[model samples]
Target: MNDNTSMGNGASQQNHLNGQWQGQPGQQGQGQYGQYGQPQGGYQQGPPQGGWQQAPQPKKKNWFLRHKILTAILALFLIGSIASASGGGSKGSDSASSSDNSSSDSAAKSDDKKSDEKKSEKKDEEKKDEGDKLPAVGTPVRDGKFEFTITKVERGKTTAGSNEFLQETAQGEYTYVYVTVKNIGDRAQMMSESDQKAFSSTGQQFSTDTSASLALDGDNDFFLTDINPGNQAKGILVFDAPKGTKLTQIELHDSFLSGGVKASL
Candidate 1:
């Protein structure tokens, strides 16, 4: 019996070492049966044998996907801003181009106006030159202090003095021109024979032959003679030139330095 008891005690110790629990003898309490083999206020049991399974984390929605309306509104605003900027730039370029074109047009108009004015002034000058041309023959013309009338002309004379001692012969054939001079001024004015001039058809100028004019028979030769105002003088001017020299025009002046009038011969 002692050997059996020792064997039972050893078996109980061996059961405790092997993590096996056994009920104590005579310790059965009906009210405490719910607390049987449970430790008091100790650590809870570990997780199950399959290892811990992490709960599926709540899935986070993408920011843009969650706020679809706000995203669309932002995209539209960006597009409108770009479009407005582009439109404003185009408008500025067009406005600058228009201003440059307008300035060019104004410059063109100003140039045209200047050109027109120049043309008008040139036409006026031309008209004035035309008005200053000499008139025809047989018309009485007034120079500074006198009015001259060319009456008639005679050509081909050789001898002129009445006296034999005072006779004068022509180097070339002598031509005679008849003229009437009238002093229309307030003072006396001299009719000078030297002031008369003749132009040939070839534009050659001929001066008066004063020596031949002084040798004339009568007092009808034009010399340096003064005539009273409102009086007239008739004279013949002597011009000596080579034979067959046809005089085309005569220029007559009131004084030595006066502006002359031309008459067709």
Candidate 2:
């Protein structure tokens, strides 16, 4: 009985050992499966947390990109606008300067022209003043008989067919001389034969004893015209003197005297 009891205790101990070995393998496999399942939950929590951080990063990147593009465009536009404004200002200044120069040149030319015109006018006035100082010609002598006050004298030709009754064949040289003659004393003077002959000794013959009659002397061929009281008679006398003659005396005939006094020219 003691041997049978010791053999039963040994078989029981062997069976216990085999069962522990088999259960250990199963427990280890189950623990490994449980650990894989728990890792799935941990992975879901990690995705949620990381998704929040990534979402803000994409938004910030998009905002930064848009802002940079806008700033570049604004800077380029400002540069172009400044260049255009500067060019326009330069053109305006040049135009203004050109206009001012043109106006100044025109004003200068106008002033010069005005000055020239004034100078010309002044010169003309001076010339006119000089001309006024010259002596006059064809001065009258006396009412009836006329004589010349000679500053210059010239010799002339005598007319044909004249009676050489006067003692002096040639005319006298006189610087100044007066001629006197009688008026017809009456309303009219009749021409006698001798008077007509003597009068005809002049170059031109009187047609009638009219107040306005003209006669020329044959001796020197001097011109003579008849006159009444207050009537102006004129005659030309020849001189042998200088060119520009200036007469200084004038003489008239009195009622009683047939001889004339000296006169001025």
In candidate 1, where is summed lDDT lowest over 10 consecutive residues?
Answer: 25-34
Q: Model 2 TM-score?
A: 0.26
Question: What does candidate 2's lDDT look like per residue over 147-235, in tens digits?
Answer: 32223322232221233442222122223122223343444322111121111111212211211111224322123333454333333
Q: What TM-score against the true fold does each predicted structure earn?
A: 0.48, 0.26
Off by over 4 Å in 1: 1-137
Best by lDDT: 1
- Please give the CA lDDT of all the candidate structures: 0.78, 0.39
Can you write out model 1's per-residue Cα lDDT over 81-192, one digit (the tens) per residue?
9999999999999999999999999999999999999997786565445433544445688888889887787777887667788777888788888888899999998899
